[model samples]
Target: MVDILRADARVGNKTYTSATVVIIGAGISGMCMAIDLIKRNNCHNFVILEKSSGVGGTWHDNKYPGCCCDVASILYSYSFEQYPKWSREYPGQEELLKYLIHVAEKYGLYKYIRFNSEAKEARWDEEEKKWRISVEVSGDKDSQFASSYILNSDFLASAVGQLNVPREPDIPGLKDFQGRMMHSARWDWTYNFENKRIAIIGNGATSAQIVPEVAKVASHLTVYQRTPNWVMPRLDTAVSPLQQALLTYVPPLRMRKRSLAMDFRESFYAAVSDAKSDFAQQIREWCVEGLRTQLANKPELWEKLTPNYSPGCKRLIISDDIYPALARENVDLETRRISRITETGIQIEGGTSQEYDLIVLATGFKTVEFMYPIQIYGSNGRPLSDIWKEGASAYHGVTVEDLPNFGMFYGPNTNLGHNSIILMIEAQSRYLNAILGEVLRARAKGKTLSVRPNPDALKRYNRELQEVLAKSSFADSNCSSWYKTEEGKITNNWSGTVVDYQRNLSQVRWSDYVVEGSAKGVVEPRKITHLGRVREESYMSNGSLILTAASVLAVVGGVLLRGSSLLRSR
Candidate 1:
């Protein structure tokens, strides 16, 4: 392993200066990319610029009262490093955040991360074959160091993730609200909800989690439901001391347990993809039963909350105890549409006033707006905003046609409907590492290398994605979701299983790229040499002959040894 300090010293040199790869966000994706680049590819000329002071990205930011992962804790973690010691099946936000921090520390990713350093804009410089990035430090408010920081790197990986910015609804009199108001992503811990009248804005995953938690302590909790989601039972359980001890001692047992969890999660994708399947019907029935049992008295409320669209149209909310929380006397689920916000309360469409001391908007995130609040200009001096004006897209959700040597982790159409995102992240990082390997080989041979996806190929890939998405529950128009953009395009989700994505990116197509170098200098093709083939051939021809010769020599040697032993005894 190369010393990170030595690696930093080696950077900015004549040969290694051009090899630096800049990663925008220090989220799960960014950290995963860094791990792959350094440990696997041995490319230490990289820097991760994170706006936040710490890691965990979304997990770090959103720390609401009852914030937790909907996905099973085992499946949510990295496949390579399975954590068999989860406190619950569905781990809380703090636990998940700690896990991410552990992963970062274990990989020594902190040295590569520059906290509070935000990339304001990145422009591709065609003449220099590098990206001119303009970054700003948060504390430097004087604007004295406004000069662009030139990063002469061969590649740019935007792992900034899709869900950085929070999306607030356009209410008529939102600014007029006199009481304290804040988004769930930006939770205000200073404001005490104890004995205070609280009003939650949206009834999505975040709201579902927050309402149940704050309702226990709040004077009054009113949940404003825009559109009710299909909520399912979360069979969460605490990890027993016995199980924890077994995991610590028996490694194979933990591996088996993780595989079992993975298999169970992957089975859900079939139901998500095909709404007409038996598995899908079973899930729907369970959801219906849950609603019927919970809201037995208030059938009207149950009917209003029940979704008309398919199960996976929007994200499925997991809560075995959310309905019980709402059933409590202190909790109230308001299905009425908000007409406007008053000076000290909210006004319903039916001329009703619901006053609250505090209002929390669990309104989710602005997912469609990729890399928002930052300008990205590609080749030909065209802004990324203008390029993807219609909708954000990338070749294989990693590379774009015109954007040479630029890669995106968890980019458009890469979000999985099933399985762990860590699995996807590992696969993407490996693919990017392969591309970087090719770039380094080209550089070593004193050649210039540029790689981009073919426009036609990209078109076909995206067309197939759109087609699958249309058939899936995400395209269901009855419910409005963050998965769909303004124009009703599903740009944020993968329409298939995680295994399919892994297979697709298993190998990088070198022919899809363009290479430039000295006219006289011959360049080696970037391809994986099949050492397995040579090994197989050698085994087939020489194996039997070599074994026979060895057997005869062994017999002769044994006879000689026996004769020598008999002579010594006599």
Candidate 2:
């Protein structure tokens, strides 16, 4: 058997001196990537640069009223770190944020992260085979760092997701609205809505959540909806203490729990993928039943609220009792077109004016705008914006053409519709680790590493992705959604199941890349380090023993079957 200490020391020798990887975001994806790198790849020379002082990514950023996840709480977390202690099925923002922080702490990932540092630009240096990243500290006036502070690794991973930019509607006289106005992404808590007339723009997830919370105290709530969404009943429940204790004591039990959650989530993939099927019919019936029960008093409201487009075209809203909130006497759901905004309120298409004390624009994020505000220059000084001027295309939604030694997490078409993105992040980290492993091997042999996907491969992959998306629910044009760009291109979501993505990334195709380095090199001897070896050995030994016991039990079952047959013959 290979000496585990020597192997780890060898791996550490390749990773200790320089950062082999730099993850740009300290969100869930970034944190997962770091854990995978350290535990699986034995890589310690990576850094996570977060623009904010803390982690949690979107959960950390958006703290608007009634903000929570649309995805079920059970399926929203890392599969390996299942939290059975959730207070609600669709956990509130603060709870989700706390979960992320807990994960970071458990993994001891705080040391690998730098807060309040934003990546300005990343340029690939052809000669050095390293990325030249420009980062600026938020409060520093002139503190800038070139490539002077990076690990010696040749790979760059951008976990800075596409949905970070807040999208402001190009409404006429939006800036002139004298009443305090703010985007859902940048919620202003100081502007009190208590006993105030509030007009909320957009009936998406944010609007749905905010409406109920604001309606509780607001004098009157007016919801401006250009298109009505298909809101479904959310079967949310709090996790009991007994369940939490079981998860904490027996980690393997959580795997069984996650499997059940995944099974339910996978059913939605089929419903969304084939919108014309029976599943879609069932969803329509559910929506109609919900409408009939909630808007029974006003049949006219039901007709206006019914969606003409397919259920999957846009994001499906989840609510335990949103219809009841809308039916309240103080709540008003207007399906009118906005003509313009006045100083104190809004003017509708029929020239009707509605007054309000505050306006909240839950317009969603600028998802189509990938890596905005940051200018990226690849080899030959070619800008990424110029390359993807028409539309963005990436190899496995991680690597791009002409952008050597750079990998991105949650890149084009990698967003999921059915499962937690933590699965995708783990898969990507494995794929990236394979490539980096080869790079280190080549370096030890005195060769430089260069990995790029074939043009034909990337073209075919993206073509299939777009084709699948065209048939999916997000492509329905009856209602405009953030999923599509200005040109009507579906550039945000992954069109297939998480399993498909995982299987595709299971192995790296060497033929798809071009590696450069000296053919001959010498391995440097280094001091032995046994970090995490004892824990790793304990787990591995237990797993091996379990497999051995299972094999023996299977043999015993066969022998017992044979003896039963002999007894029956006698």
Candidate 3:
């Protein structure tokens, strides 16, 4: 085994004006990747490129009423770093944003992040062994790149997730609508809905969140639902101060809580992956019973609210508030087909027209197109958009077949229906940390290295994944969701359990990839290092890149061990 740097070991806090590694976004995934690189890999020569004015990708962007995380707060947070004092079981967007900002502050990440810097294009520099990235920022429009900035790096990590981009439904006469309009993702906070007749369209997760809260305040809330979703009651409660005290005093207690939450969340795997299982049937009953119990007063709701398909066919919504809110006198749930947006209001298919002062499109994101509009040119000048013309895919939801020295966070087929995505991100971070260490280590040795998995390996991985997913409710059940591609392929989710993903990304199989260096052809990353001894992997050699000896620490598991956290999860 190659001697590697011990994870969690204290490394140099050096800063690089020009980064050797460039991360696309400063969101949760990007921050996690950067922290791992600096702390675990002992490399600090990286910068995060963020388009917004601050950190927090989805959390910062979405400030709509009742916007929050559905996953349990304790489990959703970073395992290694936990904020045990979360106010709720599931946190609101503001609280989540605060958590991300706190994480950045704790790790000293503000200096390394360039806010308002949006990546436009990335092209591989075959000769230079680097990526030439173009970015657009607030600058002189008449500049060299026409208001865009240039950044060059040896490696790139696309941490931009699929949910950020806002999409509107294509309805006839949309521009003719005279009322104020906005999408859920881009909620207009300044434009108040108080005493305003609000027509909220779409019934996805965002809609489910907004309807309940908006109904309480709006003069009249009209929700246009095309499909009914299987719902699970959320156990959201304020965290008691005593509980916070216990969590603060007892670190292991918080760990146990997180583990328990994860276990409970993971139980849904059967419902989504193996819909015919007993547990899946139990879940279906629970959803049905819960809806019936909540809407018992208005028994007529069973006809309007009940879904036709199975529970796990579509994304299972977790909300304890939706039923009561929709059942209110001022709230009207209309299942009629929307004909078009008129100058004053909406016209239903039954020739009925309802006028409203404002229209809130609860329509969710365009999730199938991963990293849209961001042009990434791989080897042989093949644009990533052209390659993913059919759909987006990756070897292990991280590395693409020909995108050498490039990786993505929250890429295709990586979204989870059963558990937290933060877990997947951490696993991928460690995996990428290993590869990044190898690449930079090689560069310090006066060698330029390029890395990517074999084409056959990537193909085999995705094919096996699709075959297994075909049996699941996500593919088998007839329901339209953000999970599928334009071609109706289940392209947005992981078919396997969270533990499975954790195990797969635990280690980077050196032989599975193809790597070459300028000075040394077929550069093998395997090296000589002793886990039981002391050494440093890389260091400054007279202000130039140079590989230093590896230093080891006495960890419970050996240094550079893969999937240690995954083992903890088990």
Candidate 4:
């Protein structure tokens, strides 16, 4: 793994910088992969290409008002480094970003990350058994011209998970009639909303969070909704100082809290995966009851806000303030189809129009397009765009068939509907680490190795995956979602529970893959000192078993009475 090669490449006069592995994106997935490589494999010959200036991927990109995670902080964070200092049940964007930065600094991952560097293209070189990656580096004040460089690596992995690219709706005359138009992801924080007549499009999770905050200042706000979603209460609460102290001192108590939160979140999988199950019925009832009680006086708004389709068809919106915000006298919920965008405002289908000073697009993202805009040339120089023309598909949402020795973090059919995505990312990191570790072991003996998923295995896995998903609420024809393609193929989200995905990817089955090449001379593998593992263990101080037992009883009693500050309701 330590074999570093540099050569004058054909593309410009620049030389190639080679590493054992080249990972794309420095988000949660990338950071976790780097940490596992050091902890589990004891490998440091890797480079992370981050397009942004910072490390916290989505959290860094999106800074809209009231932006917060719906999942509980305990389950949302990494398993190895559980955070006991979260200020709230559901963490806000700022807190989450700080946590990510803290983890990156603790692991010393900043040295491996190259900021302002975007991976443009990657081509597999069959003869050399390496991937030649082309990266575009944005010019800084010191540099006069932007430059490109070449990086060669034995293994290539994409940590560019879903939800990076913001989606701009194809509305007619949008560009012509735009009045201070901005997407929610790229919010203009400097712009003032006081006394401004605002129009926000889309009513998804992002919109739910933005409405309440924007409504407080806007003179009038119009929410254009094509379809209503099942909105549930967040029931968020702050963590008291006493609770934080208990969690900080009693490490075992924190462990139990996280375990309980994970199990509770995992149990909701049945409600999402099986739409007709008892769990689904119970959730639907709770949402309906909550909606009616919240909007009791304004009974007419209940019918307009309730969804006709089954629950879990699209992403669920969890908020306790959206209803009250929409009920404000200055706000209007427009259900009519948008005919077009005029110079001043949106034109309804009935030829009526309302002027607005600003338009905020809460449109979600290009989720189905995984690793898009990145030209990937796989085996025999086949372009990834042409290969996935129908829709993106991967074996267990990790390795592709033609893309040898390439693994993706959050690929197709890997997004969760009811559980934390951090779980899926951790599973993929471990799987890739296992595979890459073996490849390095073979390289020590002067052997070149290449591995790709078996064609039959890829076919069978996707077939079974889609078969199970077809019965889920996501496949309902009445609803359209980012989880599916334009052709109605369910390309995103797993078919089963989080536990199922973890168990399936627990170990790599060499039989399900086509492994090539053999080792030549008998050379001993490099002995790696497990210093990083020891350091990680030392970082988390554990108390004695007797003390931990006593603390658990005391902390558990207080948590039960105070309603478990770490847990939040849906």
Candidate 5:
């Protein structure tokens, strides 16, 4: 229940503002942390720095055609704030963005968010015992007050999750292209693709979602595939009015929907984690069935579209349209390696050049490079980039060894392969909220506090984590994924299931962190009871499974009674 907000200090031309907490992003992670700060910790003195003009993080940035989530809509959203009226089973980018905006407005977090403020550098001040963040503020053209300033905070929470920065391929002559070029993340909707030849550079998940829509409008579409991906059928269906009403009125129906998706994803862990398992083979068959069946007529493109590595090596793609789109007469699948880009188009390895009117780069993001382009210095002026020179590692992917009073959302090894990341984010939010609450308590008593993960704890945790990750399909030597570094270290995905991550972060282990100054040091471990809220609602008293079954029976019984009455009348 402590609030500290001041802007009294000024040195030369630079101004300094202080806050109890500073969250660097207005995405789901940052918003989740802000809401937790308000509800859990009762702390309101925080500022969220967002580089974009709006919220939604990745959803806000990537506004391409046919862009939608692979996960089920019911389970993809926040557990507490459920949306019963999703248009489709798999919601698109706009719907997701609307959900985020609605949540932010409901929580009244807009007052604390600085839309165009970007954190460039964050350095720990040993003397001041706080984090001094160098923030650069930029405004749109025709607007004034674009400047840079210094902000100090008692605790720094980096909610700038991965997938923010778009990665363009390092191909030669990329700049020499005279035609219109754009990355999938930065789509230009204004440009008309009708009756124009278009070339898509990558065939990953983003491209998988984009190809279908582009193929419809373009005169001719060429998809440049370096390596094919495992694609399963997306059972996307419209949520009818009846279903929406049931979800809205009967709360159990909504819980049941999420529970079903969660259970299925939980069972899907073996498919991604252990590629040799029966579940993995089953998944492979489903993917193969979808691919072969969709492109059955185009036998020539079968081998070209088949993956060389295992199904789960790279991120899995769930789409029913990508294959059929590629099978279109105007669409061509190019498996040949690209040599370089020409002024007009792309040149492949055999010196075969193809002209195109537009080029789309779907080369994804700099995922392994956690928090890149933002220099962060911790204890002893130790650079965080240098510390993670080999690979990024953190204790539970939240607290680092030397970075005291700092927590990261969706950090290294926290990304999920089989389940929704909202679960993980909530867990990390609760854990960080506990630490920040301790900081607030210290501040209430006129004291400064810093708490960082114990080096030994971090080391041990990562050692065990890497060991488990080594056994996963992501460690396959046959294929390279964005999950790994150039030196072959897995840094992006969690080694276990979402449930495992939740259990690991369910308790705040005080002994695992180093406390500084006047702070709550080691204490008996306390369980965050609310951490079990989601699972409890799914499996416990609500009895989502039983309710789901009873609801099905009720509908069946109603139909039978109606049928009997009709027969008697006849």
Candidate 6:
């Protein structure tokens, strides 16, 4: 019920603004948080600051060709907000973007999103128990240096995912490439690849889709591969008009469709968790057979495209057209490592050289680096990056140990190899909403609060998670992948299924978090918990009373029945 926030002090003639909650990024995580805050909590004293001009986070930024989700559309979306009109099974980038826009509009989230506002620094103020957030506001032509503003907030939430920043490989003379250069993440759609000899570097997840799509139009295509990936056929199909109509008219059908899709995805978790499992071998064989069937005549090509590591070690690519595209006469697979990039072409090992009009860096983004470009200082001004110097680890993959009242979706070890992350995100948003509710109550009483997981608990949780991951294919594959850091630790994947994550985050364990607030020092701490909306003792008393009455009634009925039977026997 507390809506008022202490006003921000004026700095350099710029009036700073303060909100109850300041969510960073307008991506799926941020939007989900915003919607939960408004709809469930009926709290709206928040703002979502996005670096991009539009609402869709990655979908808004990466406008590359053949961009589509690896997960199915029905399950990839929020369970509460189902889209009845997904055009494809695995929707393309544009369609996905459109879906996001539709969701944002439907939820009336546009007014809450502040676009082109990039967060620069967020420092926790211990004394004030608030976050001093510095943001760079672009597109302000009237103001010099674009506009640097401070956002003071009672709580800070990060939906800024780890995958947007594109990384180019460290190849010598990469700058010397005089031909058209582009990254798959930062795709240049305007620059024509049609009728041009194009070379794609790094045959990973993004390249798996880009290669085949580009081959359909490029004059010639060459893929430079260091390590091959296991690619299974994508069961992609267009949604017929009848199906779309059924989904639109019969809303429950979407839930059923998502449940069926989830079942298919969940069945792969065993294969992902245990590399030596029968299902894992079957997955490997499926990839091998897929290659053999597509490149039957070109046995040599199959050998080159085959992966050397376990199937789930690296992210798998699902594309039906990849092998067929590679088998084309104009398409060439270069397994040899690149020696250097020339002005017009690339030189490979053994003195082999090739010319191409365009070079596509299909390299992926920094996955282990959480919240890059934004420096966050937690309690006591300890830098978040420094605290996570070894690797990023979070309790329940949502809250870190030192970061108080700051929650993140898709944090360390939350990325699922088998199931859709939307499921995980839904659970996380709900959990964070509970934490926010607690914060709001404290603020309503004119008190400050800082919330974080206990250090011992986080350490134990992460240790158990790492042990589980050790048996998973990602750790046993013996291949360097984006899932790990330079230390070769599995930091990007969850050791369990999405359902596991959901059940764990279904409710906030108030005892698990180390709470700090003004009420504890002088006044008694608030006995607030979401356990059936009643005190623990009260709930136990009601249950015990009901059980006692039931026991007495059963005893009386048994005596009466015994007496009647004795008389009848006589």
Which candidate has the top score in lDDT? 5
Clash pairs for candidate 4 = none
- In the range 261-309, model 4's lDDT, one tens digit per residue, is 7777778878776778898888889988988887776788888888876
Looking at model 6, which ten-residue stretch has the lowest summed lDDT?
531-540
lDDT of 1 by residue, 382-428 (tens): 88888788898887788876777788888888886666777777778
Candidate 5 residue spans exceeding 4 A from truth? 1-16, 140-143, 520-533, 536-570
TM-score of model 4 (CA atoms):
0.89
* C-alpha root-mean-square deviation, each candidate: 8.4, 8.6, 10.8, 7.8, 5.6, 10.4
217-334 in candidate 3: lDDT tens per residue?
8999899999998888897999999998877765546656776777777878888677679987887788889888888888887878888776667888999989888889998989
lDDT score of residue 88 within candidate 4:
96
lDDT of 5 at 287: 80
Clashing pairs in 6: none
Q: Highest TM-score, which number? A: 5
Evaluation by TM-score, superior candidate among 1 and 2: 1
What global local distance difference test value does model 1 have? 0.77
Q: Show the colliding residue pairs in model 2.
A: 18-152, 19-151, 312-473, 313-473, 445-521, 447-517, 447-518, 448-516, 448-517
Ranked by TM-score from best down, the candidates are 5, 4, 6, 3, 1, 2
In order, how many clashes per candidate?
0, 9, 6, 0, 0, 0
Candidate 1 wrong stretches, greater than 4 Å: 1-19, 140-150, 514-570
